[model samples]
Target: MKKIIIGTLSAMILFSGCSNFLKEDPTDFVAPVNYYKTEKEVFSALAGVYDILGNRAAYGRYLFFEMDMSDQCYMALSSTGQDIALYNYDIGDQKLVDTWSILYQGINRANMLLERIDQSDISETLRDNYKGEALFLRAYYYFLLTSNWGSVPLRLQSTKTPGEVDMKPAKLKDIYAQIIVDMTSAADLVGDVTAYKNAGRVSKSTVWGILARVNLKMAGAPLRDKSRYAEAKKWAEKVINLGYHTLNPDYTQVFKNHAQKVYDTKESIWEVEFSYMSGSQYEEGNVGSINGIGTSNKLVGYSYGAQKIMKPYYDSFGVGDLRRDWNINDYYYENEPATGRIVYAGNAAAIFYNRSASKWRREYEITPQKSVNTTTINFPLLRYADVLLMFAEADNMSPEGRSSQAEWCVNQVRQRGFGNLLPGAVPTANVDLPTGLDVVDFQEAIQKERSFELGFEGLRRHDLIRWGIFLQTMQGLKSYKASAAADYQYGFRTAENIKPRDTLFAVPRSEMVVNKLMEQNSGW
Candidate 1:
């Protein structure tokens, strides 16, 4: 069983710079100085840091909705107004306020934990581990902030009074520098994967994987720092060489494992844990409800049908790619047992609207009934397959473009997707990379591989943005959706409406109104 970290911080540290609308006065709150006297108290504090992952505003909702803005999926016509605004790139919309608030809340918890843990009388190893976990989490939150908003205010220390709060945005480069420093220190202090009792917690491999992603972002688009390309490759390679993780061979089993609350630590590096059994609505994860096919679709018994996969993206998969069959379900099983009796729901046009994000299928969920929207399925934050793809992309960007190592890394992912096809066997069904591609072509191939392999996983938008093709790709998608013949139609976005400033989200209007130092991104 996965060790579920559950704890509540005694005091909620409000962002004091913001007005009364944003601040919540503490009640019966034990201050950190008064609380961190015992080892259990310090561990409970660390659990408080992990608790942020279960917040609806953070990974549970906003993060998944942001994926709709990418080319991978579209918000269904029945989706919430806020989701529509987000998908349409309405920069001034207040939809992202929760995301901004919750992330800062997490950072505050981490800061408080780091501040108090040092004074505790815990064993040296225990202290180091807790410190490492806090540092990694802090860096992770900062990464999410910097990547989404570009220049968010840096708050390393816990805010004791309203006077100490700084609302000024820091440079992205400086934020990234801190991220690297924290993660590097985290990797050193944290125990190896084997040392960790559970897969849910951070390990040495987790730090390496995150560092690879961070370095890759620094090397791409806005930064264009070529030096980081080599660093990115180094980190990804380190994770691969560690031998603690490997591909899960069967792609379909991965999600099934998630639905059953089974942890395949080999492929899943780290996952955000959720449980409907927890009895608190905040603890439930709802990705399936938001994206699954609705009962109105005459297929699934229950679902919100809020988001559907875009036709263009679904069609982009190769002819025999197992991911297409696994990720996108054109049909639903008739009976409760789901005995492979596939009933074709509709033709291409009809299925487009009803197309289910089958990755998180409700049928696979081990709940008492199918009607329950809340699921215990953990959302994968990082996986070994992602690491392999990162390695390939980073290596291709390095001086050795189409190096043998790059080829091997890319092939490993491809091979796994192809059901671990034997060497020298003709992969006619699951197509492999064509031989003798140049650096440019190999890079393009890697991009396509990631798209096909990692679609609908909330990574597409960031990937496109870092590749410097987000705007152009969305522009093309708008035109493609506009011209496509589908049974159900909704207004598609236009290229002319998307400004370069739309790349970074607007600082929440509520936040901007209260803080004089807060600045909105340009054209917002």
Candidate 2:
């Protein structure tokens, strides 16, 4: 909040000031050589770090739900927003540039805080934990960067002077190694995961979840090797055995926008914080209510009322899958502005061709977008289902590889939807699952399930790339541009014409030109 408004740029002066959430405008005035000498000031600075994690630019929209563009789901788009992501991202376009900037800005702010904290004298317990969190955050952002950009400059300390920022990019391999280290250390310092909030507060599970992901990514294609898979499985299992998390009884329980923040759900291990308060006086929206079916209009802005589900994925659900029935709805209403009457609507059925995505539907006021307390950024990082699958994936990756464990993992996830998917467990007499499936087949099945299970949670893209299916699954959406131009307001080109450099984004042109030591990622 408060930038250390130091005019002399000297350290060690203990100044006094009120602890308000200060705007950190860099281009501000000069201050006398006084400094923050109290513990309250330190706590305020720590809150600023958590606030950064909750910020809309960083995790609110982009991290929560924006990236679900594979054949499994679609977003109804026309000019302004949703359409562009669906079409442009199919071939990996400029959105990657936007992602790079947002993530780095978040990283830089967190680093600045960590630097400030290191320079201050705070309680050993709180200070060490906070420091660990800052490290985890930096590593978190870097993992997001390398996952998308391949190689990026790793900035640790806050650059006080202009010249201090002259830095070169680090190799992707090196970036990942550091990510593993930070998270591994973070897991050590963090306390027990007694509840989701405790985990939400950046505890052991959060770090372990991240480590599992980092390890899994390293062991997958593009960086292909299975060395880290067992480690990945181990970390995931550690989080699982903590006994604090479980899946929501119904698939929809964990996602209720206005529902009380219950920490009992088995599926959710970590979720980002967003609070709902009236007017712009506070941040956070009742995401469920905002997207509720009753609110024909919205508090912040109408999300264009899109829970667009693609036909192939809709059809992919087995008849008995509980997720299918629980996850979607078919109605939205609009207020007749002039007459003050209400109107209900569904997709142009012929075009959608299958059940549309139901995850976004709920009831509330509509027509004129309403403004009220809303919580739009409630994002989840881990859930129990993932742990089950992770355990299965790890078991499959073990030396001598147990195929049964992989089968159980896939079945646990499936049983929730289809019910009793044990050995010889089939949804219906006609629905045939392959007999005695092996590890590779089960691995792919889990990947597909994770895609659908965690779709639109800002995770599907990375998962697809790890599965080596990014190009394959997304390719279908390119053809959609031709058929959906008027609707989505965007079109696409053939995959052959698309360049591979698009896979790893350009290090925002600004970053590259400013930092002479920074070289662009290869093929960028």
Candidate 3:
């Protein structure tokens, strides 16, 4: 694979490079005038925008760590404990600061690219594709910002100095409006999924998938705009009707393919690319290291066992659900270093009560360097199964409960989960969708299906928040974890710690200190 080199620009960057610009009264870098003159430069600048997705502060670390805030997983005792505060909704300023800075850095890169793309001599099709990507990425960063911080300053122009650009947070509705416009325009500008040489770049299908998700969030809690349900369903159905994607028959293959860097364009609409060859450890994907099961003594790798599947979520799978075994590892083998022998090791009664989220296993990583903390795994940002589930959800949200299209969309996902089961061979209770279910029941079914289908993919919390059950579900999990017979209560928190204000993370105190125009989220 060709390595993408993310270069520096004349901007108030939060990440590495641009040291000369950072120093007062110092000068060394070329201005944007000299750059962005060629098609190669345009592509390079866009690569920089994509680079942020793999940064440790964004998807590489904090974003996935946010999953700990939900009931799906918990920070293990052996882990760094950086995310433990989030479990109790008591996040510190550093994480918020890093995430906020990195996302804006991405937005700034997109802004810089969008500002300069048209100046290049590239063909109209090429220019529009690049612009579409930049627009989609900008919208994506804004979506993350607004989703986590509620109202965030919308930075459309590139900044030349840190702490100089001050803007107030935009309203959530306004943010969504812009996201809709950008993604809608992106859909028209980009080509089909197959047109892209790789799944790392956004395509027409990718835009539709995200539009569906954005519309769903708009329709749900925090917005509760029922008017957006039809829009949500419409976009989701558009993706489904596109017929450009399908579910991978074996659910485990979806992740295994990612770990091995085997791109399955049919199921994965878009993925954030990561390479160990990037020369920076932080640039390499850390999902497997953090979420993979087994200790150094038990496995050939250096997994931190950071995120453990909570008992309740692990037990939620039905009797014949193949996804349960594929997702949660029941046991591991302890390797005797001296003898070079392996022994079956099951969890002892009270010591280790949690199962590892085995979806992204370190064992499947292609490199022979098992001790490396990072791997060349591409994280799937959007998948066809998610689109199908979103279709079911949005369709059920409408007056008509579980429409024929909705049922078929959902059933396709469920049947895929059964792996090799024949059409009629799947157990009646396992994959069958009951008829004539009410909207409430159908919605509940979709939620459960999503949990089962999308577990440990860094999506459960967002789903819970949008469904308006984040606090309620956390409270219930707390009680359940507390009552369970274990050496340590995993993911249990005191009731007082969780509040409505926690729905949005606290704007980093550092940000509030630097940006005078910024207002902290309520109850922070």
Off by more than 4 A, model 2: 1-39, 64-68, 78-98, 116-122, 195-199, 257-260, 285-295, 298-302, 334-357, 360-377, 419-435, 477-499, 521-524
Where's the lowest-lDDT run of ten residues in candidate 1? 14-23
TM-score of each: 0.88, 0.78, 0.89
- Residue 116 in candidate 3 has what lDDT? 80
How many clashes show up per model? 0, 36, 0
How well is each residue in 1-524 modelled by candidate 1, as lDDT tens digits?
Answer: 01111133464432211111111333355655677667767766677667666566666756765433576666665344444234444444545777777788778888888888878988999999989999999999999888888888888887666554446888888989999999999998888887754467888889999999999999987888889988888898999998778888778788888777777888888877765432544456676766654443223335565666667777788776778766777666555433344656545655664566667776676654433555555677788989998988888877755478788878788876776554455564535687788878988888888887777676878898898998888777665654445544452432334557766777776667656687888767
Error of 3 at 232 (Å): 1.3
Candidate 2 Cα deviation (angstroms), residue 511: 1.7
Q: Residue 298's C-alpha lDDT in candidate 1?
A: 21
Cα deviation at 270, candidate 2, in Å, is 1.4
Model 3 TM-score, all chains together = 0.89
lDDT of 1: 0.70
lDDT of 3 by residue, 1-524 (tens): 01112234743233221111111221245567677777766776777677678777777767876533567666664343334244443335466677787788788788888888878988999999889988999999999888888888877777655445567888889999999999999999987888765687788889999999999999987999998988988988888888778888778889988878788888988887765533545346677777776567524566777676667776688777788877877656455453232332654434334567778876677753544567666677899999999988888878654578888888888877776444455454547678788888888989999999988776787888989998898777665655445555634542335677767788877777667798988876
lDDT of each: 0.70, 0.55, 0.73
Against the true structure, whose lDDT is highest?
3
The weakest ten consecutive residues by lDDT in model 3 span: 17-26
For model 3, the superposed segments whose C-alpha errors exceed 4 Å read 1-28, 77-92, 161-163, 278-282, 297-299, 336-352, 420-430, 494-496
